[model samples]
Target: MRILALTSWWPEPANNGSRLRIANLLRALAQKHEVHLVSFRQEAVSAQQIQRMLRICASVDVVPQRVWRPQPGEQIVSLWRSEPASVRATWNPEFAARVGERATDARPDVVVAFQIDTAPYALHVARAPRLLEELEVGNIHAHYVNQTSTHRRLRAWLTWRKHASYVQRLLRHFDACTVVSDNEQQLVRRIAPEMEAIHVLPNGADVHGCARDWGSPEPDTLIYPGALTYDANFDAVKYFISEIFPRVRHVRPGVRFVVTGAAPPELRVALPQAEGVHFTGYVDDVRSLIARSWCEVVPLRQGGGTRLKVLEALALGTPVVSTPKGVEGLDLKQDEHVLIAQTPGEFAAATVRLLEEPELRSRLASAGRQIVAQKYDWSSIGQRLVDLVAALAPHTVVQSKRHLPGQISV
Candidate 1:
């Protein structure tokens, strides 16, 4: 079977969660079928990266992403021509034409759009079953920004409404859709109730890389690893510094917090200066930090979908204390796989308790690792994606019956 996977960018060296998801999904598809990747290349892709794709993919076509801001007349014409928000005009117009040309020659059996921005190109391929993978409900994040913004609140609110409308319009076109969690699936349905076949394809981690026995932890060390430049993560770090970490330090004076991930100067300045707070600008691997930590903290106030950070921590057998919003969409129970806290004081208390009580930390770490190994490994999640695609394009190829060692059969 020939599958055309469309993405907004080349998903190689998938250091981030979103790119990791697409890379793993394509790896799964490539195992059983011919996968031709046609994606936008925002920057010059490294030769090593293209070679990585060449190893797994049948062929790859990279469409150069260029800047295109329309003038007043062009903006009017764009609004008249498409239901998508005007911001989408920035997408290379030649993308759809390129996809059309490929479809004419390669004749793909199915088209899978990895993100909402690339759905228009996938939908343009009329004969194939179009599958849209919604990483998260974009409007939900837009709403979060709206609720949190001060000076730009009105602009954020308007953007949220526009994205909501765009989602409703796009939802009606796809044959099937998948989101990162049940919570996001419900959000999509609420926004567009008439649509069916919207499924929950939860986020996962590379358990094999993370499923290991953590060595002796550094006493009183807490780690928070994520894309710190993202609004929610930046806010989470700031919230911890402002409201949560001080409370923890008061209880445990030696407690030190490590904020690790990519960050901009603005995000860095947003974090309050404190004696115990340390920031690692970017990390190639967070497992070392997680392994050496007394516990991992996720004090997220606003974010949608399940957190890969939580999954990665759990897979590493690192005890985790997170806010209810932090672990949203994951099937985790308080005191079982993780310790959930809603308020800053509660979060701080959870952190201090995990630090002081060795037995509690051990129990949570063991349970969390067991949960991810059993349910959230990449192989199992990849197979789930395959199952959905198979159902949509059953005539294309027979679904593989094989599963990874720890993977549950799809």
Candidate 2:
């Protein structure tokens, strides 16, 4: 079957969780089906990165998007008029047009949109069984709204309201939807209760790629790998550095905390200047970093969905200390597959315990690896996705109406 997968970003050499998930999904899907990927490339990506993404997918097309920032005058006007700075005009009409043209020619059996932003393009395609993969609900924006100051909170609230409406509207148009975790699926059901088909397809890792020797002793380091620009990751790192790291240092001054990922300029500036904290902007081999770490810490407080970092850490047989939110989607047992901690104090305590008790760490690591092998491996998860697409296809029929100009039709 020919499948057109739409995503906001395509994985390349970059260490991005979303890109990695999408790439793994596409690669697995490509094994049985002819998969074509269309992704939106932001300015940070290069030509080499595009080529790398192409190599992973059967065919790849990218729509270049420029990050638009409001002018100083526009910002002032927004403040007075009570509008958001995030407002930007879509400039890639040709990309949408090309997708529609491709849909007509390729006549794919299925269309899958990876995120809410790409849903609009997929919705325009009227001739295929459409699946919207909602990795996370917009609940993070609500969290941000609570975290922001009064002035910012009002703007965030307004922006979130608009976005929520847009998502609900799009949800009705798709034949089926899939989310990374049960938590996100529940949230979707609450908002769009009428939607019959909502599947919980948890995030998965490349277990084969992550397999390594667990017998070798690792360095006394804790690693946190994720995109720093994301609020959840930024908050996790900030909480660790400000509240948890200090306590951990007092207990074990020799242990190092490594923060590894692509950081925005603002997050980069806020890095702790302490002796034990090492802020590596981006690294090519995140697995090597995980392999060398004593334990992986996932202190995410404000995000919905299953974290790939947790899966990757577990896949590498690295003991993980994370919040309940961090391990929400997976079937993990506390003190076995992973250590679940909520507060900063509990998180620090768990980290220290894992670092000190080698036997406990070993037990947790073994259990975690077993969990990944059983459930979160890419091959297993991908087969489930393939089955869903096949099941939905027989009931799906192509509509004759052409989508509006600049719209994507699946």
Candidate 3:
């Protein structure tokens, strides 16, 4: 079978959670079928990165991402468009033409689009069974509505209406859809109630890489392994630094907090300068950094879907201290798989306890790793994506026997 996988950006050297999902899913599909990848180049994708894709993809095409920003006095023009700037910016004619041209020649059995932005491109693949992968729209709904500013609230309301309407229209075109969590599934349902076939394809980690011990966690240290480039991650780091880290530091002055991922210098300026807080900008391998931590702290007050950060930490036997929202859609139990704390005071107290009580840390780490092995391993989750695609295009399956490990026998 031939599969055309569409993404907003090239998903090579998948250093981040979103990239990791597409990379793994495409690799899974490539094991049994031909996968042609067409994506937008958001940044300079290194030759090594393209080589990584060549290992999994039969062919790859990356065009420059559509660069669109509201010019001075374009507010009226943007409003007249009746769609959010996000949707307007990603509407690339070059990408659409490329996808259409490939779909004409390849005539893929399946078309999987990575996000809401790329879903429109998948719709152009007129005959294939389109799977809207990881269409997590909850992030758009999670912002700006609660602000005190009247202008901001009004803008957010308009943005929400336009974006929701656009997505609802797009959802109707796809044969099936997948979200990272049940929470995201519900968010998509809320927008397109009449639509069906939305599956929960969870966020996961490479547990195979976690087979060997990821080294003993360093004492008096806590880590959060998400990049500050994303707004939610930056917000999480800021919140931890401002409200939670200070409390943790007050309790244990020698404790260190490490944030791993690329931190743009501009974004770094906003984070409160503190003594024990350290940011390692852009790590090639974050698992080592995660494994050597005493605890993984996810003080996320924003964002939607299950956190790959949590799953990766659990996979590495790193006990975690997270807010309820941080573990929102995960199959985790409080004090069993993780230590749940809602307030800054509670989060700090939990972090201190995880650091101080070796017994508790060991227990949580064991429980968390067990949970990840059963549910959040990339191999299992990648197979689930294959199952969904197979289910969508069952005609592609010719036998009762399976071709790949964990295949659905479709």
TM per candidate comes to: 0.88, 0.86, 0.92
Candidate 3 collision pairs: 261-282, 262-282
Candidate 1 stretches with Cα past 4 Å from truth are 64-86, 138-158, 213-216, 397-410
What TM-score would you give candidate 2 relative to the actual structure?
0.86
Candidate 3 similarity to native, TM-score? 0.92
lDDT of 1 at 189: 86
Across residues 1-410, which tens digit of lDDT does each residue of candidate 2 receive?
A: 77788887755654677777777777767666666777787655666665555554456677775467667666546544422444334446766876787677667889989876677788668868889876466465546556558877776666565555556777888989988877777777876788879998888888998886645555679999987888888988888888888889899989898888887777777866577887787788788788778899988877766788899999988899998878877899999789999888999999999999989988988899899999999889988887887777875442322222222222
Ranking by lDDT: 3, 1, 2
Model 3 lDDT tens row, 155-199: 777777778888888878888899888888888899899888889
Overlapping backbone residue pairs in candidate 1 total 0
Of 1 and 2, the candidate ahead on TM-score is: 1
lDDT of 1 by residue, 271-387 (tens): 788879888877876788888897999988776767888998888888999998888889999999999998888888899999999999889989998999888999998988887
* Model 2 misplaced stretches (Cα beyond 4 Å): 43-58, 68-88, 141-157, 263-266, 395-410
- Predict model 3's lDDT versus the native: 0.83
Pairs with backbone N, CA or C atoms under 3 Å apart (clashes), candidate 1: none
